[model samples]
Target: MIIGVPKEIKDNEARVGVTPAGVRALTEAGHKVLVETHAGELSGFTDDDYQNAGAEIVGDRGYVWGKSETVVKVKEPIEPEYAYFREGLVLFTYLHLAPIPDLTNKLLEAKVTGIAYETVRDRQGTLPLLTPMSEVAGRMSVQVGAAYLEKEHGGRGILLGGVPGVPPAHVTIIGGGIVGTNAAKIALGFGAKVTLVDLNLNRLRELDDLYQGRLYTLASNSYNLANATREADLVIGAVLIPGATAPKLVTRTMVSQMKKGSVIVDVAIDQGGCVETAKPTSHSNPSYVVDGVVHYCVTNMPGAVPHTSTLALTNSTFPYLMRIANLGAREALKKDPGLAEGLNTYQGKVTYRGVAESQQREWTPAADLIS
Candidate 1:
């Protein structure tokens, strides 16, 4: 099997699909790996590093995409890369197709076998591939929100951890999943008063035990969300519904009622955001004002820390990549039920039920294809 690793071309995206270590692992397993020139440069890995790991360096993006049987990437393929898709090519990446109708259409039209990392599940029904990056994004959400809270950034001039005489800022996280948990951890580390809201009572109780009453955990009803937003100095929208679009927990009206210049870091922006007013921004211009509140909704927050993000992401994805490379997609997916859940689109059909329902498209079970 020939695997390709292309440099991520999304707005301000610096992470690569694989690291030198990953390439070496693939090569040792008798798979040929092709890496785009300088693909890992942003992640602090050089072309020489990939070469030493037994990967051939391709000069252009087209070569890697065209020649490889499976193309692994950090982000979804942008418009320019759409032309490279072929009938049998496998695209393994974070395809948040629920929100991107155009990309979804392209994958179907081109008959590409699309495997989304974000939808891939583990034996315990947890998102293994998405967890590492989500952890990074969740932690960074607080760090970025804190910076944007300064007066110069048009935020409510307040310190996350206040001085001796002042009260700490109120930080509200709208989910208690991996992203929200990491955000709460960082916020509490800063001595900020934190509140985490979620729909699962058992998970909430678990968090209660984990945090030991350091933060408030509330039910995820509309009234609770709105009230929490109003009291929040910084709101972290960390809600997620797997491969589906994130539910709008914080409405525009609720946002308007929040303190002026308050910051919202929507970690769920990749899944179309849980805040009604949230729109994806780039790291270069990460925040915008919406109804007197600041929104920091960068879709690729982990890209801001490419070195850590790339390594962490590859660590989880490499094992699955090797499985597909060694056994082939059909045999590998059929053998592993969890990996089959990752199949969003295969052979011109939507295989993931959540994505099919979200996109309003015809659906087919992955077993239909593999069988």
Candidate 2:
């Protein structure tokens, strides 16, 4: 099998699909790896490093795309790369298709076998491929929010951890999942008043044990969410429902009612955002003000730390990549049920229920394609 690693072209995206170590592993398994020139430059890996690990360097993305059976990428294909998609091409990447109708239509029209890293689930129902990047985004949400909270950034002009005789800032985080939990930990470390909301009682109980009364946990609802937002200096929208658009937890009305200059870091922006006001922004211009509330909605938040993100993402995705490379997509999906869930689109049909429903298109069963 021949695999192509193209340099990510998403706005402010610097991560690549594979690293030198990953190339070496694929090459050792009798698979050919072709990396586009300068694909690893942003991630601190050189073309020489990839060559040392047994990968051929191609200067043209079109040439690499045409020659390789599978195209491995860090982000979704942007407008320029859409033409590279051809019939029977295997696209392996983070295809958040439910939110983006145009991209989904393009992939289906191209008839590529798209394996989305976001929906690849393990036996325990955990997203192995999405976890590493989510962890990175979750931790960075607080770091970015804190920076934007200064007076000059049009924020609340309060320190996260207040000095003596001053009260700390209030931080409200939605969805007590991986993203929210990490945000809570960081917020607590800063001595900020932290509140985490979730629908699951058991998960909330576990968080209670983990925090040991250091933070507040609430059942998420419209009333609680709105009330929390009014007093919060910083809000982190960390909710997620895999393969579906993010639930609009914060409405336009809610945004209008929040305190002036409050910051909202929507970690769920990739899935269309929990905040209704969110529109994807680039790292270059990461925040926008609407209704007196600041929204941080960078679609590729982890891309800002390409070195760590590329390595971490590849660590989770490389094993699955090898499986498909060794056996081909049909055989590999037929063998592994976990990997089959990753196939959102195959042979010009939509197999993922969430995406098909979102687009009002006909759905294809995964079993029919893999079986």
Residues 203-303 of candidate 2: C-alpha lDDT, one tens digit per residue = 99999998898889999899999999888999999999888889999999899999998999999999999999999999989889998898899999999
Q: What's the lDDT for candidate 2?
A: 0.92
The residue-by-residue lDDT of candidate 1 on 31-105, one tens digit each, is: 999999989999999999999999999998899999999999999899999999999999999999989989999
Worst 10 residues of 1 by lDDT: 353-362
| TM-score, one value per model | 0.99, 0.98
- Point out the worst 10-residue segment of candidate 2 by lDDT: 352-361
Return the TM-score for candidate 2, rounded to 2 decimals.
Answer: 0.98
lDDT of each: 0.94, 0.92
lDDT of model number 1? 0.94
